[model samples]
Target: LDQIILNLVSNARDAIEDNGRIDIKVSTGSSEDILEHNSIVKPNADKYCLLTVSDNGSGIDEEKLDKIFEPFFTTKSAGTGTGLGLATIYGIVKQNNGYIFCESKKGRGTTFYIYFPESDEKPSEKQLIGKETKPDEQVSSTDKKILLCEDDEGVRNVLSKMLGAAGFNIIEAADGEEGLRKFKENKDDIFCVVSDYVIPFKNGIELYEDITSMSPDMGFILVSGYSHDVDNIAELNENRNFSFLKKPLKPELLKRTIMDIAKHGND
Candidate 1:
């Protein structure tokens, strides 16, 4: 769910180069309405949670709209895009039995509508047991500072708020370049770095390599919405100072990982 929102919003923001608007709406949708956009739905579910992301920018050409969700298919020039964002979004939505559709015109604008089936089942006893727990008290407070690197503003803001409410000082950066710069500036004070696996300028691995070279004992947590890349990083698994998490993040898990790293920073 987080990945869907992050990638869609990020793409919309990028499309709007300047002085453009992006709108997000969430509402209930019916199977009949969703069938107009997607044909694969089995129609076993009657209701869905509709997510709409729209941008008033230089829209896409009809010819390219069909290929937007294909891996490595990009309209942007050269090194600007990997084109995996939309593919990832499509795969995630489909994996969860959801439907995604896009509408665009060359000069008008673009809008993406996603339909996720609404489950009527209530939470189980196991899930309900911890429903009232306080997230802030789940992990011990630390005097150490954390470096947060993520390109999407919305994701970053939510993460910052979560960590801040847990009583930790946070230093934020929008990309790997700025993250590296800030790490160099406050290398002495930072206790751990929580960064997205994929970021601009440099990736998480590069940032981890650079920072670990300078401060070998620095605690690092690498996160991602994509799972295919996780198996390739054998080093992250071997390193005692490093950890990885998949999104959408579980707040308790993130907080516990950070606190564990902080408590055992010198070990």
Candidate 2:
């Protein structure tokens, strides 16, 4: 919910070149009212929470509305976005047992409504403080082997070098298919699979599934420029041992994620 709100706000800000209005409204609606008025099925009895974000910027066309939630689908220019914002939000909300609806008309405005089932359970509060690390302190990799899969050559090179410098033995693959092949060949030597979500042949999720079947205890990390339906990733994080890092990730973040995986070995 927090992530989705951030993405929507960021997108609205980008759409408006100058000053514009963005309205965020939250309320509770009865199940009957929601079903009749919003044309959405209520997940439970009584009431549900409704969150609506409206922006008075350039509105989307009707045709594009359906595609906005798809991974890598974007109207923005190259280097502007990875088109994973909405997709990621969609995945998150669904995972949390929620639903979303969007409305827009060209030259008017756009509004997104998110519905979440009401719960009597109190929300748990936990504050995450960022780990402090010194710049001079090098992250050691302990001769552990890693299967690195990334389609972009530039990103691939930088990541491989960074991991290699940390003392990891890097086995590189350009796409998912190659990643799987390398994993099979180096099953004994490899300590983890670091892969990009979007790739050729098969996707990161599919690769994760295949690798887990062969080596259930293997560690995996998924990196992506945009967000997607991360239910599988979340499940793996909960049931097995894996990590996910969003793209444009700093070196420190990557190091921390790897170290976390190495230390904990999943829940």
Judging by TM-score against the true structure, name the best candidate: 1
**Which portions of model 2 show Cα errors greater than 4 Å?**
1-140, 265-267
Against the unseen true structure, what C-alpha lDDT does each candidate score?
0.85, 0.78
C-alpha displacement of 61 in model 1, angstroms?
Answer: 0.9
Where is model 1 more than 4 Å wrong at Cα? Answer: 38-42, 122-137, 140-142, 149-167, 172-181, 195-210, 222-232, 244-260, 263-267
- What C-alpha lDDT, on a 0 to 100 scale, does residue 256 get in candidate 1? 81
Q: Which digits, one per residue and each the tens of the lDDT, describe model 2 over residues 1-267? A: 546776787677666646788899999856665566466464655667888998888889899998999998987889668787788889878897777888887777788888787877765453244444675443456667889998866567777887887778899999999999999998998878888888899889899999999998888888876455565655666754688887645565776677666656523
Global Cα RMSD, each model: 4.6, 10.9
lDDT of 1: 0.85
Model 1 Cα RMSD, 1 decimal: 4.6
Q: Any residue pairs clashing in model 2, and if so which?
A: none
TM-score on alpha carbons, each prediction: 0.73, 0.49
What lDDT tens digits, residue by residue, belong to model 1 across residues 1-267?
766776777677777867889899999998998878777756558999899999998899999999999998987778656788889889998898888899998777899999889989987997878566566434555567899999978678878888898889899999999999999999999999999988999999889999999999899999986657666667676888899887656666898899888768644
